[model samples]
Target chain A: MDYGTTPLHGLPSRVTICEVGPRDGLQNEQAVLPVEVKAEFVARLVDAGHTLIETTSFVPAKWIPQLADAEELLDAITLAPGVRYPVLVPNERGLERALAAGVRDIAVFGSVTETFARRNLNRTVDESLAMFTPVVARAREAGLGVRGYLSMCFGDPWEGEVPVERVVEVATRMMALGCTQLSLGDTIGVATPGRVVAVLDALAAAGIPVDAIAVHFHDTYGQALANTFTALGHGVTTIDASAGGLGGCPYAGSATGNLATEDLLWHLHGLGIETGIDLQKMVDTSIWLAAKLGRPSPSRAVTALGDPLPR
Target chain B: MDYGTTPLHGLPSRVTICEVGPRDGLQNEQAVLPVEVKAEFVARLVDAGHTLIETTSFVPAKWIPQLADAEELLDAITLAPGVRYPVLVPNERGLERALAAGVRDIAVFGSVTETFARRNLNRTVDESLAMFTPVVARAREAGLGVRGYLSMCFGDPWEGEVPVERVVEVATRMMALGCTQLSLGDTIGVATPGRVVAVLDALAAAGIPVDAIAVHFHDTYGQALANTFTALGHGVTTIDASAGGLGGCPYAGSATGNLATEDLLWHLHGLGIETGIDLQKMVDTSIWLAAKLGRPSPSRAVTALGDPLPR
Candidate 1:
């Protein structure tokens, strides 16, 4: 509806939204959909103009039953031209599965703090990075782009406020593992804008160009969009968002969903930045998925723009 | 819980949050609480360390039956020392009512667009301003502080994209009537960070000091916090918020609640900015109010921190 535009300096004219709804989002959701539905979800995101979609995770089904049909879902969906579907591969086994499935882009998740590393990865920070090394190395050898996810960059529920220097050190180590992009995760959604800027500044000082960094924020504290805005001001062009704000942190029970793609698009577009996303189409997709899950979408944009659901 | 703090440059170390829950928030709610409950709400807000609270509106009960007990509610609440209770006064008669009730601070509501002025104030923009002129004048004459509220400063449902210059002109005129503070309201909640910057810049160019301005944003499109952050960066220290995200625009059907005070506190305190309000106390008050209203608070911070209610 032409929500007015006023351009800000120092912001990129265009941004790439990394759609994580299919993989990260579904992995955390309780309702397990059919493989066909998962495939359709990926297709709808592609239709909504998402070029980079995390299609699914190859983690063991025992750990995440919601994405148990990763291979079947990947096979069921038609691969669109010029779109990149990145799958999460935890270790060597998941990498082999992704390789067999013809995945071209893959992501390996790590943690910045020892507590989260032990809790989420069943290892210390060093052990998790050691685990990701082989997966990232083998994927890079296969000519596949690797994205490193460094979680708990802001605040860890168990560890409290994470040190900025520690984040920079871990982020550097992860980026050195043949990763093309590093997405800093606010796993607990506890980051404010200044902390976001501090982390980005530290990364830049460590020689990590803004172009190679992406921000992944959770809206648990309603600071995701503002954090994303701060990241954009620092010249980070890629944002990791779940369509419909689908994912909640499994490790931190209080964490809400990722920054909603619809909400992010509203801000990006309203600032005269190009996202190439159809906001209405994305909102409609969230509504459609919400119905499938028998729940309303957590996205504020979806709630404000979509029709009222029947009681 | 200490959310990590990293101070940003050029932001005020402390900000004044104007609590608008009792007046703006409750006026939009469907359930009409008794005058005693309304009084308790104000008392709770003062206890949570809000120095400026909009206690009630002296508008006719026929217009807003939800706030029919404005005088009684004010009478029931004990005013805390060093706290300011500002009541909304529409015109001469409303000012008389507020004065009779011993109100030391009064606010006059105006519009930045013609349609909203006609629809909400039942007059044109000029007519509305003319009506507020006498009210603001009398309030100032009586040695009471006068606040001017300019709504639809960002966008309007009927008249889309209100011009920046128009907002500046109306705001200048409103402030000229001896308003100690002028609040820019994004009533429809369509503002983004850039638009916020644009309006604030225009106002500054027109000789309006940042200290004399406040921002009132709605979370309808999930832009309020981001917009608020942008406003803070522009040196705005006064933020208008409703506890528990309580208000929705009566004129804009799809509009969501105001920026929740708890959510705003999370961002402000996380940035190392002080608000003097206890976060836990505010969340508790919102939880208590939500229970009385038979609904959960829309605040993300409250939802994340407060225990989940049984379905």
Candidate 2:
């Protein structure tokens, strides 16, 4: 009932920003950049004070060809002290590949919808969850921090709308699978703040602690920042954002991309929430990446703040 | 507390959208469209099921030349029986001009910041309010529904952050002057949902009903729709938005423009809140307007939901 902006809104004083530009962002880009460009982008994000960076995905080279140079990228960039590099691991083989590439932290992705699980991972929802369990266990046994991704948590293109209860059930099981953190992903970006609150409350009621949850949102419908704020208000931190909103998946009905790092930081800095992100540096990075990607960034702040108006 | 995406999140079942694209939107444009084009734009909006279209402003030609077509535009358009055409009146002379143009609904604009008032109206806040007293009286005596706009309610670029109480005071004074509704304007777009809730709750504590208040936001920081969602949660229904998020004022520090109607409709429709807007038609109007304005729209929905990717 406290309607004040004095940091008492249950938002975390310091939020962990998991920069996913190198892996999630570039993998969705139509034009694949050179491995050095990807490495530099990661290095720039690291320079911008992002402690946790999703470096790459260890899937087969053909699966996400844009990020095929995951190993090449990892080798080129210097791993700084206190910085965590988390890469996506689809299964044990992906985990092995990631381990071979010196990945100490890894993400395992699943889906709440049967259709997304089927189409994306070629497995049903239960099958995908079943698949992630061992991958997570193996990663944790390897002393790697595991981040669980629950895709289509809000709505799926084929499934219409996802129930919060279903999401909660799967999320709980994922956390039970030794996953350290769960990021409830709105893959289609249809989740509103109200819906976000609903999902988070459902997870809490099912005994999932707030400390174990991160909210990853795509800015498809411009609901990303608002949903992020709502998540923050619910004691959720560890937001996953892409530099320049890089991953615009055109095949996915309405997936614009992940929340832009600059856009997210602007709101956080304004609300006095510390993310330790040098926003001006992020903007410069986004502008630089926008050029390398051969497109404008979908970030509102990137467009509004400094980038020249195309008009 | 129900985390269900059901209809019961304290949001109004029906919401009113006041279209301010013409008066507020075009006035900020660098290039002025001719009177006929402006008239056609208004007609297109009316055809797209917007009942309340802010047709034009009756201010001096030199001040806001973009809307200098006030008389001509009002004269050209055929006002529908049920649709309300609200033209802005800056003073008694502007009101007289509006009345001469057969306007039945009018709006009076003011600023919460003394700096904005001095810059825009050439007076301090008190002096500007004093100047509007007779304008409101004349418009009310003529039986015209007068909507009041209190800008910089959340922030002022020159004066910095405006306290919620100062906003409430100016808003209360505006409502007392026979203004039918008071729009709390986040002119600088620095308002977050928490700030919005704080300001609205302060107003409610001051005995103002949420029904009599509307929120006007610019998408400067990508907080418009989120702020709107927060306002809706507080039982405030009426919202102000531009058709294409058309108003981008470069000089306003952070004020990008009004929240796009398409972006707003996208979120409301997603939440199952009814606005009676034909979103496709609105998109078409925006596409057409964007072409006329020689720039891509700042609206995410306009870009994402067909109308062609402006990237």
Candidate 3:
């Protein structure tokens, strides 16, 4: 419990964790919980001091049955005053659905690799960008903050290692769509620290400030926290994580879940960086949600500190 | 897998991994594997390009029945040239047994906290040091390499938080006792990157060179890999790991296993740090060992890539 507070140089004094358990996490789950449960999940996260939570996606019910009750979930939960609930909006139709739900922040998910763009978004790279362009434009016009998610920025299943230049190009295009923040994702979770530095340096070289970038990593090879450490050293302040390491890549068959929020907080809070989230509360939330999901949480922090709350 | 080799500025280009699955890992398991299986495990690790391995301990059979066949195991396996197999020796008796078994490298385990020293070594901190003094002296006089393991270097359950000065003091004593190398252990896995940096910096300030220090971390809170990354940044080239994340702290009820060698290799190899071990071979070894132990591996790399061996 006593994490000796020692701050490192060149790292952010505070970090913003964007909880994606309700959306990115549940979307890949086989068990579809009721809308009320999803609502409670978001509420528990907010109670744990998460200010930014990705509520759900507005995709069609037939596509992702797990998150089909997005509208009902939004209606079921109370919106905290300062909390920002961002929903993933794939295209113009999804954006319309989000707007109707009184969403203030929306995110557009794009793919860095051509193969993933076609497979995941059902469009080529440029076509997917074209689809998101109007969605972002409309969201921006509606005074909704737009967050751009660039998936497969590190690697792609069909197309091996993604080029940094290609990621930079797609990232700039996504940012040009009026997105306030861009979450660079290692979709298949094959990124190491060096590759992380390379991509971030390339983005900086392309005139993209570190403040505008958020890192979303997976623990597929147990490199998530280490890679996150590298990103923090590069001055990245925003991170996307799931409560219990909830979601695996639906595309990459061997991919693991997103970096667990508990694990990330353990690293952040130990470094004397203020995140404003209660570690114990978040661990309890993850444990409670894991029971609802009929499985144990994959987060190491949850596994180690979950059973009896570890003093 | 095209890890995009980009070396960090301050990290070591090559790292030496000391595989402890046979000794440190198996010691905590309820199932005591046959000596033949243990020999094969060591063989497989050597085949996977591990240059250094902790073969077994010289403790009495009553203390650790799991490694009771230490002499038999040393005789059963073929010791490859250039590979160093270190055996744990508790005192002069254990050292005599290790020397009788023809062990060229022996390690003495000490504690940074007094409570753990009394609980684990059955002696107070200074008393334990006094006990190890003669063993280290005799080992060095016998032309054998000596490694000193300082456990609970970051936090202690009974003591709460361990001071940095205490760690440096014990580390210097261990080194002064003629230990060729000293491994700083985060026994309960409660360490973070900043604390790791702080400890290493304090040790460096106390005239303990980085090259003489190795890091042994547990993944109790999922901070092992992140903490290892911090150690590498501090120019510590040697790392202690277990195949398949084999061992858990018997003292800490909620503690998980040691840092998985497969997971560690995934990070090190991905960073373009030359640790000669083959990742696939190590994963296969963990999978095979997990099967023999009748349990799935705790390593994320094994879980993510072990299903069918991703292309």
lDDT string, candidate 1, A161-263, tens digits: 8999999999999988889999999988999999998999999999998889999999998999999999999899999999999998787878889999999
Encode model 2's per-residue lDDT on B200-296: one tens digit a residue: 8899999888888999988876778878887888898899999989885544755677999998887777677888888889988888888888988
TM-score of model 2 relative to the true fold?
0.92
Candidate 2 vs candidate 3: the lDDT winner is 3
The DockQ ranking, best first, is 3, 1, 2
Error of model 3, residue B66, in angstroms = 1.0
- Which prediction has the highest DockQ against the true structure? 3
Least well predicted 10-residue stretch by lDDT in candidate 2 chain B: B1-10
Q: Which one is best on lDDT?
A: 1
For model 2, chain A alone compared with the true chain A gives a TM-score of 0.95
> How would you encode candidate 1's per-residue C-alpha lDDT over B136-177 as one tens digit per residue?
888889999988999999998877888999999999999888
Q: Which stretches of candidate 2 lie over 4 Å from their true place?
A: A1-8, A307-311, B1-5, B34-36, B250-253, B307-311
lDDT of 3 by residue, B89-127 (tens): 999999999988888999999999999998898899999
